[model samples]
Target: MQQVRAVVAREKDAPVTVETITVPDPGPGEALVRVQACGVCHTDLHYRQGGINDDFPFLLGHEAAGVVEAVGDGVEGLAPGDFVVLNWRAVCGQCRACLRGQPWYCFATHNAAQPMTLADGTPLSPALGIGAFAEKTLVHAGQCTKVDPDASPAAVGLLGCGVMAGIGAALNTGRVGRGMNVAVIGCGGVGSAAVAGSRLAGASRVIAVDVDDRKLEWAKGLGATHTVNGAQTDAVEAIRELTGGFGADVVIEAVGRPETYRQAFYARDLAGTVVLVGVPTPDMSFPDIPLLDVFGRGGSLKSSWYGDCLPSRDFPLLVDLYRQGRLDLDAFVSERIALDDVEAAFDRMHRGDVLRSVVIL
Candidate 1:
């Protein structure tokens, strides 16, 4: 066993504390990672809030980049000293989704066979199965997706979750094409990444809609072709006006709220796709769009899971892009913080004041 410092949310609605966690040596099909950096995502805050579940004493960080410290029996293709981005979904190739060749939709993903626990031997529920806000963490061998070591760990770690989701929403789920007009609602970290993705995918017009002026400004830097102050104007009307009254070819709803979802619904051009990347609370209702419109709309309505990404396929490609300076991933990092600063980071995130506060170990 190894003792390491980690952020732990002991119970629902309680503050997280830095504590010593006992991480066991890698067992079969597992690897031990020394986390270099982890991004402070909203999902981590959700875990702390018990929004994900009632699971107590959760190990609460997932968006991570690390170096492999050790690989256990039967592990292959990875070794000590390898730089990697930790992924939550370690696909089971025999699962229905993987057998069907859509491993991105794998239904039976898993984590390490054994658990990392508190000093008292109480098992900790790792956030998204990747508890990365630590000096070290244990994960399934498949969870470590190797990336170029030259890339920035703090920036690339964001790709483990939020940024990847945004990019994948446009490239994979929405199928945004050249000359397509795209509008993304909620210009937070994920939404800004969507704007970047739209531009990368060759969308001629990428409109970012957000209430926060700061977020809109950040979106512009990430390749948004235009910006809309949704608080100042009707977002649907503004989007239509920008698109010659035809609406957008693809509308990404990155905020999981009924009102914003309705805005996305009406803001789409007929037959245009709608990609919902934001997570909604269970009490949130589906938008009350008319049934007739649902039947009349000729396009797809989809939910993006982890940006519908295949880590092995996408992580390295994105890292290379970042290294080439084609992708401005570093823009998403608002600041670099110590692991002990997680609580303060949550405050900034809740205020919608920053894109991401990364914990650098």
Candidate 2:
């Protein structure tokens, strides 16, 4: 075992503290990674708020890129010195989803069998099974998806979560196609990435909606052809106006609220898709839309789970696209900070002041 410094959250609504924790060597089917960069995502904030679970002293950080330090016995096709993005879902081949050839929806994923412990020997729970806000982390071998080393760690790390979800929501789940009209609600990192993804998928008109004008401007920079300030106007009507008064061909709801979802439901053209990529809290309840409206809306109402992405397939392809200049992953990273600044990053996130604040180790 090796001792390493990591940010740990001890209780709900409490601040995270930097402390030393023991990082054990990888066991069977696991690998130790030297973390290069990790992004501060909303999910991490949720975990700190005890929204995820009651696992105290939680080691919080996912959406990371790193170099493989060592491979445990029984691990194959990986070695030390490999550059990889850490993924939360390590598909278990025996799971029902995997057996059905949909490994992307693998019901049972794997994490490192051994635990990293606190100095007093208390076991620490890893956030998303990847406690990467540290110099080193251990994870299931399958969690490490190899990518080009030339790709910037901060940029590629975003692919491990929100960015990938947004892109895949458009390209994979929504099946956006050439000349399609796409409108994405919410102009945060995920929503902007969806707009970019729609453009990359050949969507002719990419409309972005947000309450903040600054975010709308940011969305346009990411390839949105039109921007709607939802705070100033009716989003559904604006989207309809932009798409010949019919509505967009596909509407992506990235805000994850009933209000935004209702707007998305009503803002799409007939027989159009509604992709719900935003996450909703447990307290939020569904709206009482008439069953007739559901029946009349002649298209799919889908929820995108991590954008239905298969990390092994999508991560490398996205990194390659980034390298080819077809995708601008770097544009998503607004700023970079050290590990100690994660709390401040969260503050910025709460204020909607930045797209993504990455932590460079």
Q: lDDT of each prediction vs. the true structure? A: 0.94, 0.94
For residues 1-361, write the lDDT of model 2, one tens digit per residue: 8999899999999999889999999999999999999998999999999998898889999989999999899999999999999998899999899999999899999999999999999999999999999999999999999999999999999998999999999999999999999999998989999998999999999999999998999899989999999989999999999999999999999999999999999999999999999999989987677789989989989999888999999999999999999999999899999988999899999899999999999
Candidate 1 runs further than 4 Å off: none
* lDDT assessment of candidate 2: 0.94
Tens-place lDDT digits, model 1, residues 1-361: 8999999999887889999999999999999999999999999999999899988889989999999999999999999999999998789999989999999999999799899999999999999999999999999999999999988999999999999999999998899999999999999999999999999899999999999999999999999989999989999999999999999999999999999999999999999999999899999999888999987977889999989999999999988989998899999999999999999999999999899999999
> Deviation in angstroms for 353 in model 2?
0.7
Provide TM-scores for the models. 0.99, 0.99
By TM-score, how accurate is candidate 2?
A: 0.99
Model 2 segments beyond 4 Å from truth? none
